[model samples]
Target: MHFQYCPHCGKKAERKQIGDEGLIPYCTQCEVPLWDMFTTSIIAAVVNECGEIALLRQNYVSQTNHVCVAGIMKLGESAEETVIREVGEELGLKVKSVEFVKSYPYEKKEMLMLGFRAVAEKADFVLSGEVDAAEWVKLEDAPGLLREGSIAWQLVRAVKVIFDDHTLCSQFLRDYVDLPYMKGIRPEDIEDVSEQYVTLFAEERNSDRVKRVHVGGGSAPFFLVSLIEHKTAPDYNVCMQVFRYMVYIWETYEKEAESIQKGMAKREDFLYPPILPIIYYEGAKSWNVPRDFRSRIREGSIFEKYLPNFEYYLVPLRDYSNEMLMEKKDEISLVMMINKLQTAEDIVNFRQLPGKEIEEILKDSPEHLVNIIANVLRAFLLKMNVPVPETERLTDKVREKKMGELFENMEKMDIQAERRNTALEEQRADEANVRANEAEKQAAEERNRAEKEKKRADIAEENSIKLLVELCQDLGASMDAAMQSLRDKKDMTMEEAQKKVEIYWKEPTDIPEKKNSPNG
Candidate 1:
């Protein structure tokens, strides 16, 4: 067994066991166990007088010959203290102050390394035994020399922070987080944190001042109210407050002011005064009004006659330049008015072009131009009640003329198609008649050839029968008997029998001479 000291508590730890692998230790004094004991180090990114950085060469197996500077933190020493002490001992250079940059967790040895920026008061090369060599290198070339996961890379990032513009960071924090938080709170109630900008509006004739109120509770119910005095009429002072409240309610609730200003605009109506303006003043917090008739009167005014004139008080802020506003004016105006309407039925809806038409439009337009058009159309369509997919405003007569032209083209196409089909049908009928005539001519020629062949066969048969009858007559047979024999024995026709009789007569038999005299 071997003994060790606890790095955290600095107490002698008893070695519980030792094996072929390693020794396991537990501290009896601190009542804690340490596993995988490792050393932690701090790396300083020291910049010299010439705006150059300091680097050290490594020789260990983990990182060989690559440049990095790191030293183990001594017991009971803070991370910053270790960096200052390490730079002095390693390079023999004095540093003025160490700025803590960041800490990175290294998994290889279960260690957390801290990186810091140290500015050198003076440069004196005094290399320690641990570092083979040290040199000042340019900041740009530092990344190439330093190994990944080394302290050198972290130092490069910290220096980049120093060189980066500060305004971008301020703007980023304000837009994403700070502005949203400030806007979330009621303007009058915001004086708790933003007291420098709050102000009171007083009556010109009387010293009595007006108040700003935050009514309702929870997330959805709250609103900000500002009171103002009537310029000429003293009795109408409360009425003026009602008017100001109407404006404030709409500006805050009805209008999507931020999105509209950003050029990606939308509109939504509120149950209370929908559109409210951002009022700028200084040093006023919380608003109060008469508890009895004034509050009831304000409520009644909102529900009764106040709804119709709400849009008249709504004013669009002129923060955007005229050119930008003109570019987005139709979209912004369309959205603003659509939201102001009591219901979707109040606004007129236009027929929208189909997707194919929209795609053709996009293909013809430039990328940026198309995107702006699409965004504007989308914002308008969102507020409208009807399913107007994509529509742009044009003169009514022009739209009607375009529709008429489209119908005319369709009618012409249909007529041309019908004429082409009729011509094709006529051609098909002519072809069919030609084929039928050729078939009939072939049949007639085949019938005539067959009749000629039958006539030639009849002539050959007559010659054969005559020769047989002549042979019989030469043997002294009677002509009449020979004819009757050929007819009966050979089944010959009458014309064949008569030819046989004539052939037998040429043989000069007694019966043949009597037959010729009687027949003549």
Candidate 2:
């Protein structure tokens, strides 16, 4: 509430500078600054055993969009109390359990909305007089029924993703194995034995441990235990916590060997599995502390031999940008990218155009994985308290694939990429054909030029022979002169020279005829 007059003394307030608060309404009589006050409320996504949400239709809030059960906080009541009371009063159903989700600030209503996921057994909802109607909406259908950016939608989405730790862990491992840090850890090598260890560690810890066995060729299988912890805030004791968990896992293995392996626990041949501890931090603050357990101990160098030394792989989501995550082209990278969203614009932009990585995933990844990615995106957008068209589009993209349209899209993309490759090959072939044709044309031109030169040489030789014969006849020379000239100038043999002289010499006519008669 904004105070124009001091409530204590009913004196008119004046604007006064207060330290770091800047200008504030100050009353001279009370010597106090009046600050704006807002109400607090609780918003809950009531879920049942069948994984359906109880969405209520309230005309006052929104006629078209549905809302979750929400109510103003009462005096001397905690936020959890408000959730239970509101659910009981509004829906007349007992909340089996309640989990606190993220808080949302409703600026328009001047209220802070604390979101919760309240699970209840499926039963008929007893709607209050204020509610027009209430229906059980499937988890997948909640986003469509509620307003896109409303608190109700956001809460429902959060609840949908909260229980999906197994899927999340599997996806993380699949992507994590590809990183260079986990050297030689291939996807095929990861064998999840989580079920075997779940019962052993359930009493001591709640977080599930993903135990994978790496079976090498003709060798004993090695056990790799992965402990993944996600922190939204910095925890300095994380190293100690990881160390304790690692010890517990080893202890569990030892006990299992003792009970199941017939006295192998006490044997020297017994071995403990290697544990890989990883911390995934998405907090706004930087995690600048040391990751090694030895670093957490004071002056551990002196006692290094006696002390344990193990380091955790820290995956700080803030250290990577959206561009960096997009390069990974995996589901976990997409999750990290969504976690890095700082504004509604960023969320909307990503939803609208998720980049090439998403296309790669769509084209190559399995259908269930695509569906999981779509749900992850929807959950992220809803948790961010803003809705973009991309969430619905992505969800529909997955559903369309299930209905065969999505696979068609993938096939279309594959065909387009293949066509581009084929077109390049055809272009190369056409270029080669053009070069071959040019070479053939040049060769034909060269052959024709050689033929023309040969024909010219033949004509010149014929003209020279005719001129020589006429000259011999004019000079009154005999056929012997012509023969001698053929032998000397043409470099012909005696027989060849005689033949040439007889054929070309028109016999120096009458003069050659008299010389033969005289000789006879």
Candidate 3:
């Protein structure tokens, strides 16, 4: 009868008797031919003191009796970690510095066995529930105890070769030792902005006597005054008060004043009460005043604008002598001029002086006041030291051009940085591609080697079987019985078969000839 069914679909069908015995059916759904399958396992070769190696006897399965302490490598664990962990759990002892030994294919299953030699620090021979018993047997004797043609025997042979090489032992130690203090960020790269500011500035208790107010709502005025003072004298605190007062006046005038006249009229309304009352009492000069009134100046108040020009207003105090000018000048004359010049400059620069009031003050002022005013004007102009109004527009255009150049340079820098990064990325990708290609080539070579080895092994097995069958037939034995006997003997090969055949055919003792020894 011939049977019809789809193995891939798991569907049954009507059966028919088949003529040929060798014909096999393929799965309809997957179009795959049926084949045998097997699984892979890992084994560990654990060596201890007394020159003995530890081996495990499995509770179940035939070949399991010939295995070493081993288990399946769990997810997220390495082969070495698995071996160490398994040894501790199965033997109730700690394993140190596990090493990889060798791997090979066995029967239908592939075995990657690791051989670890640790000085059995402490061990309690408590048989694990899964293992019948554990034993520490001598290296040479291990082969006899272990099941023939098993992974355990393979592991023993690998360990013997590894232990004999002292260079291999040194390399193993170099790979596993933990070196001291190898990692962290460097100290100099750390930044603390807040601490930097605190360290740079000098700290002092600020008093409410004459608090300075800034015009632009920042510490910029303080920064400017500090910079200027720092250049002049290292310990110049006197200018601090002067700059504070100037800032206060500028800010007050900007906030409250409409023009020079109105600002002067409302001078008493200034927030700083002391300076406001003193400045208000020292009233400005009037144009309609009598000649006698202009001639007789007050002790503190001086009509500075009544002078000939701005430069004359800045005359030093030493020029006005006590003896020569006492009859003509009051003792307070120099002080009053200093105060007037300072106040006038402050008010004028702040745009607090009205146009009509300035013109009238100029017309009515005396010669001395005019001279001082001229000097003060010159000092103010020199202090500014700016280009003329027409030249300033050209200077601004030049500044804008320089700024554009700076921006262009900055953009170029950004472009160069981006290009460098792109180049670096391309280099990394090229390196990765090269590495991937090398790995693939190496893998292909390894696969080719394995296939070659497998083909050689199959040929050897076939050769052994054919030679044994022929020898058995010559000896007048049945083909089926010979094949069964060959299959039953593990590790049977063509070499072993030939040896047995020769030994069986040898005559009983026609005294064998001895070879000439080296000593003889």
Candidate 4:
């Protein structure tokens, strides 16, 4: 069952033709069923009293690749029991408490993963033969270190959520202990992992006013780790700004690489990690933002080729449904749903939220829930100068229907506002176009003047050359000697070289020679 070849006879597997299951793989020589079985394993994000999560690097995985404590589940052991045993065996650390986080069906190794979150009283670590080293990463920093989107990576995300805010952690775990990403693999594998996953280096570039977010992960010697955040709404000028951010990151890495190349670094290490830009947008209207920089330029323009031609992964979250969200129910999806509720024309459209969306809300902290509810209410009353009601308004679960009236009223106001704003925006756009045209015209005129001046200069130089040639013929002197005599006798400037030709053109005459006595 561990491998394709029979353990008994070392013969390859063949299709066993029987039963409703189509072509079950089996070893004919040993007469045993391979049955497409996968190894069952347990992985845990162990947290210590200091609120730091435990991570380890295995002998197989490179030093840079760190993961949570993980190992095979021995026969006849519950997934929960395995979590305790594995932590003790692999890290020599005792887990006081362990909670099931999620499960994942790993296709790469053909293993079934049961994820857990464990807590310990101490921060000490004694790594085993399987683990090369262990690090206790702070909960906030754990997401940044985890291999983004990997099973271990995803588990750490769920565990860290509880560490960040304990109130909602249990409630969230109760409903979403089995994450949606692990569907059909196991009944207990589901979770959300967006908190602290983004590690931004260019902190100064973005201000607090801008709600910037990044989510990304990748592997190995030539690994690429990009800090990507989700952005919503359509911003026409956002492309150039986003491109600039990417350039800054690339340039930073390039500078580091250059240092290593030039022996400026103390170590002989060299690495240039790739960056990927991801845009996750969910707004009321469709994205009017240009997909590529070229799309913004006027069609058939001569300068099109000279303009920027870069592209990014634009995930239009508005296009997906809550059902789709169930399969990937996490912070990003929740954000998208919140945006959708703000946009729906009909209150019934709010039901587009996945069936278990309530569970998602209950799983988060009360403060978090309050914020979401408050935001929704505020989005509805954006036109009004309203003093937002206190958080207690969300106490009644039945208020969803009552909130429908508010949503409907907001839709009516939004429609009128949308029309007015659209017209005004169109007028402004036309004005901008007119100004651009005028500026272009001025630039063209300046270029035309410069071209004419250059032409005049060219003609003058040609005429002067012809005149000098004729002067040389009349003087019956070599051109070089005549020019040299003018410079040496009168100290003629190089600019007036042609002037000397003019003087030479006069009839050749013998003049009285005077000796320079006092001055010489």
- Which candidate's lDDT is highest? 2
Write the residue-wise lDDT of candidate 4 on 1-520 in tens digits. Answer: 3466776788987878767876766888778777667899988888775667787888597557788888887888866577778888888887665555568998679888877777665657777887888888766456557675577766764442321332223223223324331122211121222111112222322211111111121231121122122344576865665566556555555666666676533344644444334454656579777667676567825677787677655656677765665555444344345445543353356543444554554354244433334343333333222222422242223134232223322223354555578679779988998999999999999999999999999888657655655656676777566666556554667546556565545554698899899979
Model 2 residue runs over 4 Å out of place are 48-50, 157-165, 168-278, 282-289, 292-371, 379-391, 402-520
- Per-residue lDDT of 1-520 in model 3, one digit per residue for the tens? 2235654577644332334634455454555544333333456667654446777777584454556787767787766566667887777766643544455555434434444333344355766788777777655456557675466765665453221222222221122212221111122221111111211121211111121212233322211111111011122232343334444545553554355455654566544322210011122332222223223344313664563211000112223332322232321232223224333233232233232333333344343333333332322222233223422332232223221121121111233444567679779988999999999999999999999999999889767666766667677775455645665663556556555444443234587899999999
- lDDT values, one for every candidate: 0.46, 0.68, 0.42, 0.55
Clashes of each: 15, 1, 29, 10
Candidate 3 or 2, higher TM-score: 2
Q: After superposition, how far is residue 25 of candidate 1 from its true place, in Å?
A: 11
What candidate 1 gets wrong by more than 4 Å, as runs, is: 1-37, 60-65, 121-124, 161-520
Model 1, 271-388: lDDT tens per residue? 4523222221111222132222233455656565544442111122222222332333222222222222222232221122232332332344333232233333333332232222
Per-candidate TM-score against the hidden true structure: 0.27, 0.49, 0.25, 0.33
- Model 1's alpha-carbon lDDT is 0.46
* Candidates ranked by TM-score: 2, 4, 1, 3
In angstroms, give how far residue 320 of model 4 lies from its true place: 22
